[model samples]
Target chain A: MSNEVQERKARIKDMVVSALEVEPEEVTETAMFVDDLGMDSLGAIDLLAALETGFGVEIDQAELPRLVNIDAVYEVVAEVAGWPLTASA
Target chain B: MNTTTLVRNPVITAWSAVSPFGIGRDAFADGLHAGRATKLALDKELWTGPDAEACLVPGFTAAGVLGKKGTRSMDRATGLAVATVGKMLDDQPRGREIATGDHAALVLGTTTGSAQSMMDFTRDSLTGEKPFFVDPSRFPNTVMNCAAGQCAIWHQLRGPNATVAGGRVAGLHALNYARRLLTSGRADTALCGAVEEYSAARSWLDRVGSGDDARVLGEGCAMVQLECGAEDPGRRALAEVRAVEFGVFTDDCGPALTACVRRALDRAGASAADVWAVSPSGTAGPGEEAALREVLGDLDAYRSPDLSLIGDTAGAASAMQITAVLAMAERDRGAAGRVALITAVDEGVVGCAVLGLA
Candidate 1:
């Protein structure tokens, strides 16, 4: 389960980097996508599409606010995916 | 025939182009001076149709050239237009002044924004699980005004945005429109230009329409900054916009262009004897070149190196022709303070513009 979590997190980070056009270092755990990465609304939509394809989860448009940071993104994605969330997550 | 009076003769203070030669103003000028054919095989991913060789801006990838952030969903024509405008803004000394505030306007010309994007979006809508399940981000590229709109947005230009869809004469149409914008006081600075993006869909269209006369396809964008009453003493004026005349013809553009050149020169207070350089469009009708020769009455003036090496850029042809004129006038010490003539013909529309080089 821990290994699965790590893999999923890495995959999500990669998606963030690709969709937001941010460097790996910029995709910190708590870095806000809007403030730190300059993700516009269109970029957020693109990230949503990438997230759905990456995790095979249907993300509601209403939950877009939860995508502010990397950790929050992982939590929403994990919660929707029925994955076990660790205390740190 | 509409023409801008040479009385106010707005000058082109800066210019740039993204061409098969390469990316900047110098890149294109250098390519022209080198005098080599710019044809190369396109990637199969771009086009699998026949005519393997096309003059594409070498090593161009929207995201690769313009960073991936806002360009992920951007189409090629939009990317080329944005790059051309940005290059002008970054390359020219008056860049900061020209692209400033709501006074700075942009007018881009094209046949139909991005033919590939439109085809792709339509294909996606048809092939997707459902018709309405198409990618939303790709919607903008299907519009004819997309490239112009994107350029305005990317550059934050708040002035009037116009997209001229005049086929081969589109570029000249854009220049004329920019001239009017300045003359009307609607804009203090106008960036007028044209863009063409090579694609498989465009190739198929050419094959369908052009019998055997089709020139090999090429992709590029050329832009010039026109300012009215520029106050900077040191500002570079590559040339002054003298006259832009348009005409419609049934078949032979020879008569139409002859009339256009005559009217343009007359409007600019220039005679055929004053034109020291001529940049004729490669796709010009059979008699068009003869007409220009007859009008100018001198063969040497038309001796400027033919820019056909750049390939037929369709809507961008006239703009590229203008670019070639400017590029030549820049180095030819003999051409200083002289008039250069540029002519273009497409479909039934024929147009000509005379620039008084400075």
Candidate 2:
């Protein structure tokens, strides 16, 4: 993976760890937020706000529920922030 | 049949305070004993408004004391209440043991949940690209009952959750509510208290609302565990809540308070001379002080209100007043089994509580 991919993942991980109150190691690419990270409805809202704040992007309200894990969040943030989605993946 | 005489007053089996001096009961006790001021220069980053100082819980942050988990959306008032409940439970094994069951209840008092949270949420909605683009997570904090609900949620208090908002008398309202809950058999163990948060919004409101009388806005939480049924001889307690009486002052606060204090003393089966300590709400005018002196005049009791030590704690003021008396009781062996009084007069309301020290 390119440095861009690593950086985006790292930044997204930081947001997840802070917003969801999960450990960095716990926010693995496939780890589900509600199932694995102990996040509930409020946590989901907080994470969505954090994404909008951290990336300086606007995410569709519908996209909040789809942000199920680190990989999902990385994709959504990259897309909303206008990063090259294909290269990020 | 006089119900007041037959009613079993719940003993405060355990109590805790997260005060301007610091967190926990011991810190508050030390500060109260010292009777020193707790006002500090406001953090410039946090506030650069008209007020330059406040009595804030030293080095307090929602995430700092409660950890990062579930704190991102927790406002200061809720955070303080949660922390105080945690400390109260941790202070006594009985509180933890009794309050963990389905019988536990919570009653929290606040001026308003957190003025800052409400203002911030409103600002977000008004400034967002779309009116609905605001963070929904903050909506909970905007409500006056949020801190009480959060305390119940955090502490697993499953019974009779309540929140009372009556300005400085909010704490008294909460204590009375808890007593009723226990008397009504709605809860076995009721954790009750009040909290206030120092913020730019609250400070601004305090200044405008209180005008000349507003002292340095102070913030903290103080909680007491009220248990029903028989008192356990093995456990230590701050006081047995003898009586809590509240009345409205249509015109004269002094006369209203004097009557309320007399009623409370009568119900508690105690006289004015029996009161070993008195913690008056510092926000009220000279009327409150004069009434207190008239009732417990020339007594050798500890008569100082806790305002100088903790500043105007707002909703937490009454609780802190009770805490001042309790803190002194903890140090003096002679204070055990003595009666202590706490009184508050806010706007149209005058209230008092008599505690039989344990």
Candidate 3:
């Protein structure tokens, strides 16, 4: 993966952690927003808005539900921001 | 009109409070007895002007007690109400049983929903790159009934949920509304309370709007559990709500308060001299006090420690004051069997409630 992609991923991770008020270690790639991070539907919407504001991307409402984990969020945000998604990063 | 004739006399089963003094009744009573001011300088980030004071609940974290899921979207006012109701239920042995049932209701009083959230959301919509980029989750918090509705949702209270908005007298209005619900059989148990949240907007408004710099702004929530009829076995009644009266006046609140107190006492079959303690709103100016004195006649009347310690809580003031009176009665053995009167006069409205030891 390129340094820019890694940096963008890191920034998105930080935004997710900050929005959820969770620890960095807790926001693992596999951690589910609802099951692990304790976010409800409303909180999920808040996370979407925060991500949009943070990344300067317009996320479709339908894509919100798919943003369940850190990996999923990174992929969707990366695609929307036109960042190349490497096989492993 | 004679309001005393329509008395139901509901019993106050359990109560709880969150104020600048602390979270519970004991903390409030201790602060009241200490008689020291609890007002503190507002955070510089919250207000832009010179140092102003406010009575904010010390060390309150909603996540500490209510966890984080349902609380993420909750504003300060809603958090206060949820916390107060949670504490009230925790104090009662059968509280869970009562709360889970469909017969339970929640009524909260507030000046408005959350001025802070409303302002923030609107500002975001207007200034953001896009017109609708604001967070949709915050929209619910902007409604006037959000606090009460959130409380019901958080506690599983499925009965009628309502919110009464007004000035300081909102507390009395909420209590009286709960009393009617219980008497009319619309609800068997009512979780009634008042809540106010301190925000830079509210502080600025209070500062510029009232022109009364001496009156410090405060925020907190006070809740009481009201049950219809007499107390059930194993449940102790803190005080019996005998009667409640409220009315508006154009200019002079003295006559209106006097009349309201007269009607409440008459409904309770008690006189002004029978009132052991009187809790008046902090906004009750000299004229209102003089009117109350004229009606109740130099009784053991006092304002809640919250008024001097925390500042005027606005909508929550009357409920906090009533909770203070109940706490006083519970702490002092001599206060038992003595009737207590709680009055809130604000925005040309006078509200009064009569209570006696059960």
Score chain B of each candidate by TM-score: 0.96, 0.95, 0.93
Predict model 3's lDDT versus the native.
0.81
Tell me what TM-score chain B of candidate 3 gets against the true chain B: 0.93
List TM-scores for all candidates, in order: 0.89, 0.90, 0.91
What is candidate 1's lDDT per residue for B1-358, written digit by digit as tens?
A: 4454443878898899999989989998888877868988778875775667789998897888898778878899999999999898999765966675688899998998888899998997797655654556778999999988988888889899999999889999999999999988899999999999988888888877886444688889999999887778877678899899999999788888899989999988898777788887867655877898778876674547567788888888888888888888787898887898888888899899999988
Which number leads on DockQ? Answer: 2
DockQ of each: 0.31, 0.44, 0.43
**Candidate 2 per-residue C-alpha lDDT over B1-358 given as tens digits, one digit per residue, 9 for 90 to 100:** 8875676778787788999989999988888878778888887887855687788899899899999878878999999999999998887766677785688989888887899999999998788765666667778999999998888888888888999998888888999999999998899889888899888888778778767544777889988888765557677656888899999987779999999999999989999767778888866777887888788885345655456666778888888877777788888898777798898888899889999987
Expressed as tens digits, the lDDT of each residue in A33-75 for candidate 1 is: 9999999997788788778766667889999988998778888
**Top candidate by lDDT:** 1
- Report, for every candidate in turn, its global Cα lDDT versus the true structure: 0.85, 0.83, 0.81
lDDT score, candidate 2:
0.83
Model 3, span B1-358: residue lDDT tens: 7754564578998888988888876677788777767888777775664337778888676776578755666788888888899888877777878754699999899997788888888998999987677777778988899889888888899999999997798888999999989888899899898999888878777778788778777889998999876446767788988888997899988899888999999988888657678888857679777888788666445323345577889989888888888877877777787788888888778999998865
Report the lDDT of model 2 for residue B266: 96
DockQ-better candidate, 1 vs 3 = 3
